[model samples]
Target: MLNRTAKFLTICLLAQPLPPAALTVTAAASENAALRDISKIQVDERRLTEAVASRTLTWLTGSPANNDYISVGRLANFFGFVGLRVTSGHSLKRSEVARETLSVLTEQQRTQMVSLVHAQKDTLNRAHEARQEMNRALEGLLAFEHVTREQFIELGRDYGAREAELGRLLAQTFGDIAQTLSTDQQRALTDIRTTHLSGERRQGNGGGDPKLRQSKADKKELVNLTARFLSWTTGSQEFNDFEVVGKPSQHFGFVALRIGSNHGVKRGLVAKEVLEILTPSQIDRLREAALQNAREFPMFLEVRAQLMRVLETSLSGGVIDPAHTAHLGAEIGEIEASMTWSQAAAMLDVRDGLSEAQSADLLAMRAKYTAETDSSDLDDPIERGRQLFAQCAFCHNSDSRQPIGPPLDDIVGKPIASDPAFKRYSPALVRYARAQSMWTEAQLDAFLKSPKALVPGTFMSFDGYEETDDRSALIAYLKTRK
Candidate 1:
C-alpha cells in the first residue's frame, strides 16, 4: 500500500504542466509560422548541408578548391528542383534565397517575431528568478512560519498555482514563445509545474487548524512586502504588492508634511504647515489651477494619489523598509518646490520692502520656522535662476533652434507679436503681441507666477510658479539670455 501511494504521488507530480516551457513553446510557434516557408524549401538535403559545411570551411581556411565545386554542384541541383535556374540568372543565388525569405515576411509579422523573441527572453529570466524565490521561501518557511517539511511543500504548491496564473496572464497579454522553446527549456518549465502541482495536492489533503492557516496568511503578507519593494524599485505596477489598509480623509497638517516628504517635491513649507492649509480660497485656486493647467500638468493626479498613499502609510503603523524609505526621500529631494504667493512678490534682494513686524508675523504662525540672514552677497541671481530652470529642462529648451516651446534666448528683446518661424505659438499670443509692448522682467515675473491668469487665451500652459523665489530665479535666469 505504501509503495502504491508513493507511485501515485510521483505520477501526480509528473502530470503537472510546466508554465515557462509552455510559454516558450507558444512563442516559438508564433516565430515558426514566419520561418516555415524557408524550412519547407525542397532542396537536396545532403547537397545543401555540404554546401553550408564547405562555406564554413572556406571562411575558416581562406581557400576554395574542387571540394567547394562539389558543394556548389549539390546546391545547384537543389535549386534546379525548386525551378531556380542558376545558369540563366542570379535569381538562384544563396543571397537571392535570403532576400526571398526576407521579402515573404510582412512588416507586422517581423515586428511580432522580434517582440516575441524579446518577450520570451525576458520571461525566461523572470521565471527563473521566480522559481528560485519560490524555493528559497519554501526553505525559509520552517524558520519564519515553523511549518513542517510537508506543510512547506504544500504551501509552495499553492504559491506555484498563483504564479502559474500570473504566467498565463502574462503570456496572453504579452504574447507566448513556447512553440520555439528547446527540449531542455521545456523540461525545466515542466519540473516547476510538476513541483507546484504536487505541493497543491499535499496542501489540500493535509488538513490543519484554521488558526494556523491564518498565521500562514500573515506570514505571506510579510513575504509580499519584499516583492512589492522590488516592484516599486523596478517601476512596474504588475508586481504591486502593497495594500492600503485605511480610509482616506483630509488632514491639512498631515498632508503638508506628507507632500513635503514625498520624493521630488519641495514646496509650500509654511503654508503647508498651517493647520488649515487648504482654505476655501486656496482650494478654489487649486481647482482653477488644475483646470487651467490640465494639459501641462497631467501628472498632478498621479502625484496627488501618491501623496494620499504616503499619508495613509504614515498614519498606519506600516513602515516602508529603510531601503525603500531612502529611495523615496531621494526622489522627493530632486523636485524643485514652488513658492507661496507672498514669496513671489518679495524684493529681489535685501528684503527692504518687508517690515520686521511682518516678517515676525510670518514666522510666528509656523510651528517650525527659522530665519537665515542673506549677508554673504554670494546669491548670484542669474546662477540661482539657472538652478531653478533645471526642472523645466524635461519639457522645455532654452535653445530656440531645438525646443518644445519658443526658445527664451534673446526673447526679452524680441517684438511681442512677430516671429514667423515660431509656428507653434497660440493665436492669443499673436493677438497679445499686437496689442502689448515687449515682455519686461517684471511682467514676465507676474506671468510666470500665474500664466493662465495673465493671458487667458495663450497656450503657455504651465501651473504658475509655486514660489516667489523660484519665479524670481527664473526671471533672473531669463534676463541672462541675449
Candidate 2:
C-alpha cells in the first residue's frame, strides 16, 4: 500500500515539476500528510534501543538554541532544577548555576534524583529509539528521486505510533518526579521555572555584555581552564583516542553532565593539583597543548556551524547534493579529531613526569565520576555491544553511507578493506586484507582487540577493547547487523 501510494504521489510530483509554485504546493501537501500520519501511528516498545533513549532524553532536556530543533528550554529548566544539567549558557565552560543547584541539594535529594533518572532510562531510551525509527523511514523516503505526499504520510504514521508511546512514558516519568519532589524543592523549582519563562534580558554592565569586563589575562586564564577541564574529563593522552570522525569532546561533555554535572566542582581542583606537580618542562608542554586546543577548538566550532548550515538547507527542502553534506561532515570530523589529539598528547607529555603520589591524586579525582558498566543488567552481548557502539557512531554509520569508515552492513565474513565505496583504507590494511582474505570472527575479534596489532598502521584509530567480554560483545553485535 505504501509503495503504491508513494509511486502515485511521485508521478503526481513529477508531472508538474516545471513550476516552482506547483512544487511548493506538493511539498506542503506531503508535509501535511506526514503530520497526519504522525498522529495515527503507535510505538513499538520492543524495538527501542539505548542510543534512541539517550538521544530522546538529551533532546527533551537540552537547550533550544544549541542542542537541536526538538530541544525545549522549559524541559531543560525542569531538569536543571533537578540534578541533571544537560543544557547551559552558550559557553564551553561549565554552567555556574547548574553546579550551584546540584551543590545545594542534600545527599538524599541527590541520591533520589539519580535513582529517578536511572529508573526512567529504559523508557527514555525506547522513546529515542522510536524517533530513530521514524528518521530511518524518512531517510528511505528521501532516497527516492521524487518523494511523494503518500510516502511522507506513511512515514508519519509509523512515527506517530512511536510518538504516542513516547508521550505516555514521558508523562509518567514527569509525574513521578513531580510527586517525589519535597514542598520546599517544589517551591524553589517553581521560582526557577518563572525566571526561565520571564525571558528578562537585563543589562548587567551596559547592554548585558559580560565579556566586555574581561581583561586579556582573564581571557587567557579561561582558555587554559577550559583546555585543562576537557583534558581531565577525558583522562586520556592518546592521540588515536581523539582523532575519531565526530565531535569527540561532546562525548566527554555529555558524560560529565550525566554523571553529576561534576565538571564545575572538579575542574578547578584538578587544574590546581596538576599544576602543583608539573615540572617546568612539563608545564611548558602542557601550556603548548592548551594553546593548540584553544586555537583549534574555535575552528572545530566554525566547521560544525558550516555543517549545520548544510543540514538546515536540506531541512528547508532545498535541493542538496549528498556529496556536499559528506564533504562538510568529513571536514568537521577532521578538525575535531585534530583538536582532541593535540589536547591528549599534551596531557600525556605532562603526566609522563608525574610521581606515584601525583598520579594517584589524578586517578582519584577521575574515579569520582567515571562510571563502570553494570554487567548484571546488560548481560546480553548484543545489548552491551549496542551500547558500546555509541562511541563508534562518531565514525561509522551502520545502516547508511560510511561517512568516515566502511559501512558495517554485513561486515561479518566480508573481505577486509573490500568495500568498494570506502576508498580511503590505508595501504597497510589492504595488504593485510589481501593476505588474510575474509574477516572471520576470529580475525575480527583480534582486530577489535587491537587494530594496530592485526594490521600495523591501519587507518582505524580505535585503541581497541581491552576487555575480552567487550570485544566478544562488540563482535557478536556486528554479526547481527545483517
| Predicted structure with the largest TM-score when compared to the true one | 2
lDDT tens digits, residue span 327-426, model 1? 3322221110111111111111111222233323323342132211111121676644554443343224432233345656665656764656666777
lDDT of 1: 0.31
Q: RMSD of each candidate?
A: 30.9, 22.1
lDDT by residue for model 2 over 400-458, one digit each (tens)?
Answer: 33245677767889988898877778899989987899989999889998999888998
Residue 340, model 1, lDDT: 11
| Model 2, C-alpha of 98: deviation from truth (Å) | 16
| 464: Cα error in model 1, Å | 1.5
lDDT of 2: 0.39
User: Against the true structure, whose lDDT is highest?
Assistant: 2
Give the runs in model 1 whose Cα sits over 4 Å from its true position. Answer: 1-378, 398-402
